[model samples]
Target chain A: MPRLINRHPGRGPALMLGLVPFIVLIFAYLLGSHVRLAANPDDKLLPTPSTLMSTLHTYAAEEDVRSGQVLFWVDTMASLERILIALVLSASIGLAFGLAIGALPVVRAALAPFVAVVSMIPPLAILPILFIVLGLGEVAKIALMTLGIAPVIVRDLALRAAELPSEQLIKAQTLGASSWQLVTRVILPQMWPRLIDSLRLSMGCAWLFLIAAEAIASTEGLGYRIFLVRRYLAMDVILPYVAWITLLAFLMDWALKILRSRAFPWTDMSR
Target chain B: MARVTVKGLWKRYGDTVVLENINLDFADHEFVTIVGASGCGKTTFLRILLGMEQPSKGRLLIDGEPVSPEPGPDRGIVFQRYSLFPHLTVLGNLILGLELRRSRVLGKLFGARRREAIVRAESILEAVGLAGARDRYPAQLSGGMQQRLSIAQSVIGEPRILLLDEPFGALDPGITADMHKLILDLWAANAMTIFMVTHDLKEGFELGTRLLVFDKLRHDPQAPEAYGAKVTYDIPLRRLKNDRERQRLAIVEASGSEPSYAPAG
Candidate 1:
């Protein structure tokens, strides 16, 4: 009779429970850094919290030597721009292709196999090809990210569109919706939240591609900075940059979840 | 309001026949209820009437013109499920019909027309007893409420015909009874014709002005799919007063021609 173990924990307790793992991770990293740096002051593998803090301050606060801008803000902006552009392109393209594939048999038959083949070819493997074809610019980098994630998005959305109950389509038609109206109203509205969900899922892949592209060839970006300082084994910069990326990804995902719940509250119940 | 005429209709999928030799005339403002056993083509007939399905042979005419094969504003349908768009609220669902028909862009009703649509939708929602649940999503509603919302959504379009395919099949008896009253009231208020498919004999009898039974009169054990269901019995239930009288009409089996009707003695 221990109050049924409080099946639903209070909000404060739940928040604390979520933070426990992060706190443990931070403490473990701090302990490791302490033990390692105590023995070797110049150990580049696990930098001390002081070393990381100084690097963070420099990146975030100080101006760059050449550009007269904060390198951290510049890098963050560059990476974010690519990620956002690539996501918008993929989302629009994926939604269009997915809706076509789902609603039309001919489109599904013709494009499905091509999509499957493209999805199977790893996006990273074709990074050089993208650079070769599109050239080593923002276009190539964005293309790499889009290529990496769009096919999977298309495939997922197509499946979802196909799985949509025929009754809804029929009902819409009976309600005076033309084919175009049906697609825009009935199909598109239903897929909007799912598209956001697909994009949210693809964010991780988007980051991987962005980093890979930036690391290989870029003037300034989060990924480029991480790779740029890696020559001297700048673990302080590398670890914080990685953590920042993780934080950004988590925030984007959380925002999408909130948006989905607020905008399409019926989504969870129907599925 | 529309007159529906089915002439020498036959539906086949591959070699199997689903419905054959279906001929009937549905007058304007008629409350026609179709009842049959499972897979007996009652739903198919309703689908044909809604222009969702095509007969392999013959034709369906609405007001003397061949009804288009594609579903349109002329016919509105309510299925057992997926009747209302889950994403839209009850009020949104009700106004959607007018918005889609009137607005240049779908789901973007605005200005004076939007205000008019809202006013119209609210009145219909009130009529269907869903005034309080206007902003609630269809999923938030009970089965009965969802069906009511769906009916409101359909009727808001002012379609020539409203087709219901076992709309109350999922509801309990009390809710079903309430739905029956609501539907009849809607029918009384609107000028649109109604065609409802149901498995419940009592429901068909109680709600319908005219009753049509679909049954495979010529059963073949060797070639079960050879013969399809037809209009085995067509009864005018407006004259009948009691359950016993309706049951008497229900028992009359089909001859080759459409069954002749007489007032209950």
Candidate 2:
């Protein structure tokens, strides 16, 4: 662990750099809520950070909170679950597609036209069609999110794989690498950086869809929480959740970037 | 321990004849090198011997049997560019050929201990002077180190015919000399059959037991008296039999024509 740390001391600065956005977002949200609440001094029942924090403390103090609500933590949990599932789906699908496209030019040529056409459509534009077919449920959210983000994943992975030096494969073949051996041992590891970048982008896209999907169809999720609170003008409650979501996204992106540098120390060609 | 016979080998790129009637024979454990000016088809010859390229006409036989067009364990090849798998550590790339070639159905379930493979790989890495650098990925190594890795990776596999395509063509003189010594020592140690393609004539003379010079016949057509290229030069390892004979042969080789070629400094 110490040696690994020695290898990448830049991670400390990188993490700090990654934190800039989250800190700014949190500060802006808190400042906005304070000003809004200051102007609405008459409404004690309206959402504010202090009120929501106290309510949160009370809810924790009570041993039980209702499972469904516009502003409870359940939707946040579901959104997280949806994002996690989307990550796995996008990665596997993307990697497999990437390997195929990278190894064979025909596959890339055949799929490129469709990929360009698919990525151009907005994530929200397809949501209604998905809802019409799958109904306003988890299925619609997953389908929309997967369709919205899978192309980037595939594109990045395939591009990375394609750029791999042809000599590497020739070496592997001479080294007695079988078809499967070459893919797993050579092709897969080389494509990780792009895969990591794709994952980060996919997570952001998935999160984006989580909010929009809930806004349209679902009764639960962070998007619904924001919408429900806005009806009653609950800026305080929204700030903390927004802070949590922003902080989580920042952390995930940082963690992946760290992993990318650490895991692929050999790929310092751009260095 | 292997002999290669390339007979009337003809390779064409679409319609351009890259090699025509390339008849050559490499005796057992002989270090045979082919040198040619750019586009004279020296690399194509090496590839054909290694079974990386197929002759549009003619046959390449190892011992008495025709060689496969596809690369196989019987032949080993090192590219001019160090082509070791970047993701793998030095030892990983070295033993990859072994691992991929190891019997899998029952070998993994019931073969030699994993530690033995590691130990052997370490020794091979040491032989290649890459012992300390075994754990380092290929990308972390210098160009010279990567070249050494490529050699180690090929040598450990114990292939019958080791094919090299200008392995040190891009190296500085000092590094090239060191690699030349390292490779010669390894070749002597195993008495391995080596086929190297080079554009550097002196390096060819220093490293190979036989030199197959390409006869590239280019002429100023106005002078219709242009001669066919100097076709071949045998290394005359007559030097190995006795120092005096070796000197005599070197003098003869240095001054001869038709097949006589000068070594580049």
Instruction: Tell me the spans in candidate 1 whose CA falls farther than 4 Å from its real position.
Output: A1-8, A64-69, A104-106, A265-271, B104-108, B241-265
Stretches of candidate 2 above 4 Å error? A1-70, A104-123, A261-271, B105-111, B219-265
Q: Identify the leading candidate in terms of TM-score.
A: 1
CA lDDT, every model vs. true structure: 0.87, 0.74
For residues A1-271, could you state the per-residue lDDT of candidate 1 as single tens digits? 4577667878999899999999999999889888998999878899878888999999999997888999999999999999999999999889999999988889999999999999998988999998899998999999999999999999999999998888888888888887778778888889999999899989989999999999998998999999999999889899999999999999999999999998887887753
Per-model chain A TM: 0.93, 0.78
True contacts kept of each: 0.77, 0.57
Candidate 1: tens digits of C-alpha lDDT, residues B10-105: 999888899999989888999999999999988888888877788999989989999998988888899998778888888888888888888646
Clash pairs for candidate 2:
none
- Give fnat (model 2): 0.57
Each prediction's interface RMSD? 6.5, 4.9
- Model 1 docking grade: acceptable
Q: What is the TM-score of chain B in candidate 1?
A: 0.89
Indicate the docking level reached by candidate 2.
acceptable
Q: List the residue pairs that clash in candidate 1.
A: none
**Per-residue lDDT of model 2, residues A1-271, tens digit only:** 5777576537888899899998997788667667767888755444556677876654333443464343445666888887778778878888898887776778878987787777788978877789999998888888888888887888788788878877677777776766677777778877877788889877777788888887787777777777776786665556566767887788889999999888887666431
